[model samples]
Target: MTPTSLNTGVNEKKRSEWLQEVSAHLVESYEVTESGKNPIKRVFFEEQEAPLSILSHVWDEYDTYAEATLHWLYELAEGQNFEVRLKVAETVGQLATYEFLPVLRKILSPWAKSGKPSVQRLAALALAVVAYNEQEHIAQQALNLVDHWSNLKTSSSLQWTAIAAYGGYIGLLVPEKALDNLKIIAQSGNGKLFSDIAKAVEKLFNAGVQIPKLHGLVLNTLREWVDQGENTSVYRLSLLIFRGLMRKSWIVKNDIRQPTLLWLAKESKDFEDPIVYLMRNGLNLGSRRDSILAEILNWLEFVDRHPTLYKTLARIIFTLAASSGNERKRMCYYLKIWSINSQTAIQILNLINKHL
Candidate 1:
């Protein structure tokens, strides 16, 4: 047999064994009905797995031993049993309360320090569940864990696990200090982790927990990631976060807006060549160019003092103009708005006229 087929066979056999083992444990944990219509066997059928809703129903009916079940689920969450553990994590989140806070912490704390990336991620995901469920007190602990994982220096994957957990669980709280660490990680040259961090930033939006001054932090982090050449995904994801914040008008203060524009302009000095390359070569920029121009216009209105970014801004605008459709027209409108009022805008207009 081929090696691929052999490995598949082995994996299937192992999965079968694991299912049998778990099913038997579940059945044994509860008394069997005379007709053998027990909830455990019913929910966890022979290769006819039920959805999370059904599993939750089963747990509700047999909740007399919830504490035992919670412990059982925690054990399952510690392994590579993704199907079992995902359900277990959900169940644990459902079962978790203020009383079990310490228990959950004890279960999650050790995994934060050492384990396979999957296990660590799930463990942190469980914590994220707790965080999402309104346990903001644990925010400090999770923030500490993020810091701890980041300082390990030997394991970028672990750092990502922590960041992912924070994104999933506590990034809404995105404590100012944690943002500092996240910015550092964005610039650490770990492409995969930065991608995951981008995803985490995406999750932060989903979590809908508002951080104070989150826009400034996100913009600053985006600039640092772009400057460090972390990866395009990081920039793209960060841009999504920025756009979302802007659309919501969350970062409304003129002070916040002006300084951020200046920061982007200042940071542009460090990445002229790379930005040029992206302008010329970026495949994804077409879809994203409109939003990019909108941001540039917003910055141009406030960025007259930062002359250094004028040339860089001009390069970005013209390159985007090279794209087709209304995006080109939108860039032209912003170019006109800037050219009439500001030197930097006039400079951007001149550069675009000369180049494209």
Candidate 2:
């Protein structure tokens, strides 16, 4: 009837049995069930997170066939087919270990633009899935899409897609082209958009990517935290400072981590966020399995020494305690006790109260 309401007259067709062969092979390597009696959902959510290597393997195989499967995935990414789109987004994201960036960038953006919220969310989320692989150009494309959403010329769902993309790309070091734009958005955005902007600020320094006024911005922001805003604003601002400190740790070079950690310990005393903040930082840098574990042990000793940091440290622990799965939960716990939670201040002395 109407342009917006026009529906494609395509018939509902069953998925090709090609998936059967692929799914069977995928199950063996990924140790996952091939049956969609929940398939990808069963693996990503209902089960524990898999190792990066296994996911890498899955990515390899998926990429090998993605071009051939692209048509079906289109059925999933759009075709006005909700479940298909969600799975394509989800499964593809899990194995997002390749250069499918161009395809994702070219093909899916419109789908995210036109699809229903649920479908859009999945499409946007799939865009986010490749973020951790240090895929900057791809990530920038996502940032561009997010920036478009912030224009408010699109649907609110599109805006949320943008927000999630912003947050997802937070793992990326802020690119120069998107830097100022993101700052403008973060400082002024509403709802989850605000959270994303806050994270962009946080990751700008941490990603070890250069931003314009990073050094001055980092120290000044930390100093300014002594001044204030909303509680979240205060926390995020402090977190940006602290995460900046962590990001710059290799350069800080003079027991700076200790003092900064001590300052945060005092400023955010009785708060667990700073602790968790430290842990997440450690985990992100955790490419080596030994490094993460060793880092965990180091933080454990730090936690044990700082009896006063307990209350806030407790928050750090509790927050991550409800992790989405085991590896994430385990890594969160390890970081919490050793680096994130432990690296900061375990002795929750009243830094904020004393200073404020």
Q: Pick the candidate with the highest lDDT.
A: 1
Candidate 2 ranges beyond 4 A from true positions = 1-71, 74-107, 114-143, 169-171, 175-182, 186-189, 195-356
C-alpha lDDT score of every prediction, in listed order:
0.54, 0.47
243 in model 1: Cα distance from truth in Å? 14
Candidate 1's residue-wise lDDT over 1-356, tens digit each? 99999888777756447656545223323323446534443235544444444555655687675566555655665432356667656555444433345445545554555556666777666655555655556444445556777665577766776676656545665545555666567656676675566566655533332543443454455555454443554555555545543333322243443333334334554434333334332234556556655555665765576454455566556666666655466556667776777666776666656665
Indicate which candidate wins on TM-score.
1
Once model 2 is optimally superposed onto the true structure by TM-score, how far is the C-alpha of residue 138 displaced, in angstroms?
7.2
The whole-model C-alpha lDDT of candidate 2 against the native structure comes to 0.47
RMSD of each: 15.5, 16.7
lDDT of 2 by residue, 150-192 (tens): 5663355565555445444432433443344444444443444
